[model samples]
Target: MSEKPINDLSPVVIALALLIIGAEAVFQLANAGLVGGPRGVGWRMEGIGMFGYSPAVLERVLVQHDFSPDILWRFVTYPFINVEIVQAAFCAALTLALGKFTSEYFGGLKVLAIYFMTAIVGAVIYGLLVEGNAPLLGGFTPVYGLIGAYTYVLWLRLGQAGENQLRAFQLIGFLLALQLLFGLIFGGGQSWIAELSGFAAGLALAIPLAPGGWALLLHRLRERS
Candidate 1:
């Protein structure tokens, strides 16, 4: 098999990974008391309030029919901040790996589109579905979108090779199974709503993002109809 050049890794992927890791590092420094101000320890709560997505805030905006810039931007910003180091590290690792694969196969622009669109859609779903004051934070939702994109790529490859197309779904199945086990062991959170939404968004977007994807999708739809 031919090996791809190391330089083939998308700059967009590297940049996104750096941004997530960098933000997490700042948050960690703040949480460790090594950094002063909002980014330091003892202040992460405030930071979360400011950056994390709050359904209450979104609800207020909807109820009042007023959208403030700060609240409006939360949809895009929430994915950059995480609650813990381990969470951030896990998300960053996924962003780098899945982002690279998606970017290589679909191009950097599509990868970025899928990521941000998934994040927005996930946030919207969470806002509408989840109640209460628990705010949604972390990068996993968008990372799940990347996972969806990767799965789509795998699905395409499997189809072309006459392999079991369902096998491409194994990654998501495993993740969801782990999530189920974790939830059973230690109560479930609403964040899964957003994460799963992200994955669905990524998978749907793949139909349009893949090469000749739109045409293929339309043809299939026409045939089905």
Candidate 2:
């Protein structure tokens, strides 16, 4: 029997999962005084301050044309910082699941690129669209990108199998519904802008990032003409 696709995790996926989970682990341990020094209690907050994405910084650089490495790095670095362990755990689990299946088709480097590229797009859209004081942090935005890729893959598979391609969107649909419920209950913030944008960007990226994606795009274009 064939093994489940989730078992086919790639190096990039494993690395990404480890980075998110490991960072949270360190933060949790520090809070419990099991690791780091006496100052470890503040490690989580410090990490957020240092690594989290600040829209204020992005706006300042964009308006003033002063793009510094420190400010720019937040686009990618923010995904590594999570405010809580539960959030980190969910993000990491999604990364592993989606990354593994997507990697089976897109390869490890492409999978890595999807994560970074979607993250940047998400942050850019978030910065441009939302007006808030809180700096954005966490991997959900990029993991949502992976969800886009996973959905695209499922779409293609369903299409080839003569099944309902719309079914591919069920995962994202459920997730969005869950997010909506949480937002209604907990009063969520503008982070949804980043995540939703990431998913859209990821869906678009599937065209170029997938193997022979550009060629296929050109072929379709030629057919339409």
For candidate 1, write residues 52-166 as lDDT tens digits.
Answer: 8878767867898768887888888888888888988888888888988889889998898998999988998998999787888988899899889899889777766767779
Residue pairs with colliding backbones in model 1 are 30-40, 30-41
lDDT of each: 0.85, 0.88
Worst 10 residues of 1 by lDDT: 216-225
In model 2, which regions exceed 4 Å deviation? Answer: 1-6, 217-225
Model 2, TM vs. native:
0.91
Write one digit per residue (lDDT tens) for candidate 2, span 2-86. 8966575787899999999999999999999999889999999989887788678678779988778877888898998998988
- How big is the positional error of residue 209 in model 2, measured in Å on the Cα after superposition? 1.5
The clash count of every prediction, one per candidate, is 2, 0
